[model samples]
Target: MDSIKVMMDIYKEDRSMKFNIFVILILSLCASLFAGTADDPNLIGWWNFNDGGAKDWSQYGHHGVLRNGARVVYDTERGMVLHNPKAGYLDPNEGHSGHVYCGGERASIADPCTWADIPRSYTVLMWIKSQMWWTPPWPGSPNQFEKEWQAIFTKGTRGYGQLIITTVGTQGRIYFRARGLQPSTNDHINGNTFIDDGNWHHIAAVCEYDAVTGQTALHLYIDGYEEYNSPVIATGSLILCSDPVYIAGSYGGSTKDGEIYMDDVRLYNRALTESEILTAMDEPIPSDFTGDSKIDMDDFRVLAKDWMETDYTIASDTGGMVAHWDFAGAAGETTVPDLVGDNDAVIVGGGQLDGNGAAVLTGGPDGPYIDLGANLGNVISDLEYCTIFIDCVWDGNSTSWQRLFTVAQPGTTEFSTITYVSVNERWLRYYQRHNAHDEETNASNPTYVPEMKGQHQIAISITKDYGLYGCTIIYIDGVKAAFHTNLAPCSLDLLGQTSRNYIGRGPFERDPLDANTINIDNRFAGKINDVRIYGRRLSERDVKDIYEGVSRQLYFKLEAPGNLSDAESTNSKVVDFKDLAALVNKWLQQVPLLEDNLN
Candidate 1:
């Protein structure tokens, strides 16, 4: 980068570091300008609850104001979230209703871009955690709060779509209720899971219409899995209300009586497929495609591999493998058979083939990932020595929690071992939270994340010696990138006897300090070509043999963007003005991804 070079030159001249603050400021400004965003063109409105206010982050900048006692609370993962968890509506009236008031009438309500038209097909998504399920003490008067349901987001009146938290008999669930515009025919859809356990849950309500059948289906998804699908239609259209859209409560502020913490409320013009909803982040390159990182054989190799169809079978075979997944299934395949074991993976969303050897995952903090089943914990849990190998490519630069591999318990408590990359791309984490409520993760560091730019072969091995010292080795493309030796029990261990395992997802993705799911914690976006689990730790040589000694899973098959390298191969991918011309000349011959800069 020219800026970097100038800073470096100034630093060398001054030696006293008078320009330190300026250099840091420039670096920060650059990163912020290029940070990933919610880029779906179909998105009409988005309220991420950041900026400490209810500002719409989408193209429609219809900013909203808080209603009633609604207030923004700081969260570690999601900077700010609406904290409105009060259920008291009637007798005591202690229950405070809160919402983001997007002012206007009907579809025009709070919409400056005119994209918020009521449609027959639409998708609304949000993350919620019910603080409590409090009801009026005396069930004496049925003052509309008699039912244990409150609207989380509503468009207009009873004839429009709304997402709610309610009780089905005794099941605390995420519910969807919608009514067609014409005759006001209604559909009340119920979610299967009890969501009031004070755990954050991702929920989406989609109404899809088949033009041929003239029928509409309402689908409910909780935590990336579909819980309910019901078809009810006789020609449908949303009722046009003069009511303004509301988040955290109903249009008129009369609802949202349910107490819950909410964030990332989104509205799409049309129904979105699960893959689209959970798609990975793809940022646009500023100038050079290579990011001006390095230009070695590795860069050339990454460029070549970008065009060539990846061969999943090339490294599919490995001795002593307890399990392996060569995601070479067809598009729309719901099942990805485990190549070496009976632990076949069930696809919830977008495990479809990438047309290449890898499998596509649109990438989101929520679903459309490969669920390796609860039984996997029985086989892969609690091993002192083992190797977890993955062949994949990541699209985005950072995620607060993007799980590459995770084995966690399924219940409210999060007992799990998670190998992940957090907000910064600098380190690879091997964490073991001994208990669900533990405040600290045992991921004090030992592994490293390479300066990865494109497809890569990553192998993490754990070997314990008789001396009770654990050696953690991380290899990138068969070469040892980082290695550390630490006393046993201090390092990460997959505690025995657990049942939930997944690829491209985390066990809880919850903060150890607060135990709250930031929702964006496990949004691993990229394509997973192949994965292998060895019962024993892999030696450096063994790891090399499995990979092509080169630069090489989902949680989708995402084709990562390539980076540009300077003459020295410093692995600096940031494109700057100084190297643009040289990068263009070399880009034609080296990295063939001319389109990499476009997306």
Candidate 2:
């Protein structure tokens, strides 16, 4: 009997076990139980790394969660998990000054690693918030790669994170190195830049088999909206062996090196569709009122509609849909200067545009106004008023400058003051340093102008350029400036004409041909956000109101809100993969139920 049982066991192992019994059991269970929600197809695998085991990751990597054949980096400080690399950083040899690859496990050292069998195309996503910039060598530090990797997005020296790609060769060879695959493909994002600090940001990179029509894409999402994208470019095979993906650092063969914190690293075998990518990048909550993936009026409508249906218990992402007098609405009332020949008015933040491009002073067919009507007579908004706040970056640069709107002094019989506001060349230039009158007369080139690069914030007010109805008042942020000006109001008034209104462009002056002749492309570089316009002149109270209002508006617009449950009641809802699947299943079930009932 024993021999017979052993023989039977061998037979069962050699030949496939009959499915009769197992199949019957599975069928019975299926028939008896209710169907559960469908499984997520795109969730390749999830790893908390809590289970310390060598799981099979041939499909993703050799060591399951640990790819690149690297070891874990355990930091006693803050309990951060680091990874080992094939090489480490050591002082450069032969007076190179640049550090050389030490090649081994070392304490408190950051190194680069490679990967194995790189796939042709894939998508990589991760969450990283870092303060590594404050440490070690600066950008051009030794023992690091010569050229800095391109950041998908970044905050600056203050500390930031990014998703990037690069080549292995010392010469600038572009390839997808950070996430997956290498060696042979036509699509790649070699060296990109995307960094930010003290903030959790989502970064994703997608590559397609067909580089042309289905060109590869790299996205950097800060907060939510797709902040940046690269030109459609083709890449090669993404397989890696010796070189593995690096975290808190980069896979620079030899270039920029730094540290950062990362969470939720993910990779998709198949190139996810753009729509799916959008779903993954959005505010995780839907503030995109337009459904076009942007925070515009349509989205506002959704929030407004939802809020009206609910009690004050529920507020939209922007708190009751960007109000009129408050951050949730618009600035309903503000102080306006009485119209003398050339009076100045102060505007605070949170002022809403009355018309398309309301506060913008544009040039060309529309004669002149701020901003070049980039959004079709769209007033370029530079400030959002809420409550009392301080703004020092105002110069002319998009980063730091102020914009003013003027009505032009009553037309002088000798030379119409109206001409100042009716000129064709409305342009942009960096306003000179504050309170500095030494170089105000030089219209051709001001000594203290704002630069185009770097991050900045500017104030929007009315300057003295346009004569008639010059400036009724000026709003700082969204607040009404306390001091008014016909001769001297907000501050710096050396350009001749007083009573300047800060709209969406540079200050106004008596010389129509000289002042107010600026260009948008030339000025207002980088990005613009939270635009508002008011009809009344801003007072000190108004300034405070606008500052707080604008701050709250911007805050809610960018943040995830403290009261999520209340937010969900309004338009600030977050629908994950399960929600999508449930919706689809519900629709599918309806037809079958209807058919059965009819029969």
Candidate 3:
């Protein structure tokens, strides 16, 4: 009986031990999943304000104490942002009222010595939005202009070691100060870029301290680009004080009257590389189907099946896409094949396919241009309803009026054309003439200018109602830039006219009196990519999608196994089990490196 009891006790002990081991294993796995990696070992403090309180999510335990109504609020555009509403204007008598204070007993989980290291380098990153420009006044300082400095973050006492960051205005300027023992030799750096435009902007300040000489090098980055660099000079030893760090409002007892919103405040013990900063600013690609933060295997598979194809198809979404000149062909191929209709464009003059696979059009009479033969009746018949999308890069050669796309009958004063007028190289003009009424009318949008040396996506939509006046809307890079109503009732008709449509050159000559001559003076000097024309008006959302590079088609032309052309097709082949397997292999392992930058 004693031996049997002993065996039973051993069995029970073994089971309990196994259970304990299993629980430990599960806990370790969970910790590893939730803990951040050592990729940013210098990251000592991080406050995302996502917990609806002053808790530090960095696991650094540097909790904050919110004072004077400073609280975390939900922002539609941004997840959770710190909102510091002003109590009142700077009344020297009232003292500083609102701010988030962190440090002391809640000192960062990281070693405080590293932060105080004289020669240590560090980077501070945060996203801030503020409209008012008012800084807390320094105690006993009578200068009211000093109140214009709005503090974003600060540490240390007034006469001791101090570090301060503040914004001057909405013009993208920032001012930073790092003072050591000697206040007279304090380091001051100013940023040139503007960020106070009522929008959320990523701001980073990097400081490299030379311990040997006590010299500091400072650099300011706005939206990932370095906007200012201070000259290296002596600024005394950077001593870390026992005072806590204050955010949104200054440590000094003065209140800022305006409100400010801040999010994702981080402090790194080392300077972050430019590439890392860029990675931080980049927003995750919006996933449509899976709702994942990245383009995982599932999303990639869906994108592959409809690869390279646009969402709007010729036969479906976009009504009657008469012409679609993709300008994609062999390296030197001059002819641009029309993807939808039969309006293929024949490249004229000295034209060649550029490295970017665009039709490079030079300026002048001999410059390259596309000839869309006289049969554009399907596109311009009604003239009242039509949408044209063009992707091009301007060369900044504003010597003469440049014709982007135009349609007109040869030797006739009655025609419609889109041109970049010479008076304001940035303005885009649409002119139409009705032969029946012998009237010529024009509409221009001054703000629709393309960046001189950058790529631009332009969409023009024209619509008309029977009794109401005709309307023309111009969208640049997906955003509507201008909307104009026709001065007179819509009477323009290009139906049966023997019209000549051209891209990069005007059908009418420079001499307005002689309509028969070709106007080489207004030739476009730039690269032209996918140019599509629809006989019906397109919605603003449709234009925005196209601008953002959301396509539906996967394959331009079917190729046999191993003979696939990477340029023509977005996906190598149809998505199947192999693609699924690849995705499964990656699984949750493909997280973005900059996820720490966001809340």
**Superposition error at 11 for model 3 (Å):** 33
Candidate 3 global CA lDDT score: 0.59
Please provide, for model 2 over 552-595, each residue's C-alpha lDDT reduced to its tens digit, 9 standing for 90 to 100.
Answer: 22122223222223323333333333433332332233343323
Worst 10 residues of 2 by lDDT: 413-422
Q: Which ten residues in a row have the lowest lDDT in candidate 3?
A: 136-145
lDDT of 1 by residue, 315-347 (tens): 333345668888777766667788877888876
Candidate 1 Cα errors over 4 Å, as ranges = 1-39, 85-96, 106-115, 132-147, 157-171, 181-186, 229-234, 252-255, 280-599
Please report the candidate that would top TM-score against the real structure: 3
As a TM-score, model 3 comes out at 0.44
RMSD of each: 21.6, 18.2, 15.8
If the candidates were sorted by their TM-score against the true structure, best first, what order would they fall in?
Answer: 3, 1, 2
Which is superior by TM-score, 1 or 2? 1
Candidate 2 wrong stretches, greater than 4 Å: 1-116, 132-195, 211-229, 235-241, 249-257, 281-501, 504-508, 511-564, 568-599
RMSD of 2: 18.2
TM-score (all chains, Cα) for each model: 0.39, 0.37, 0.44
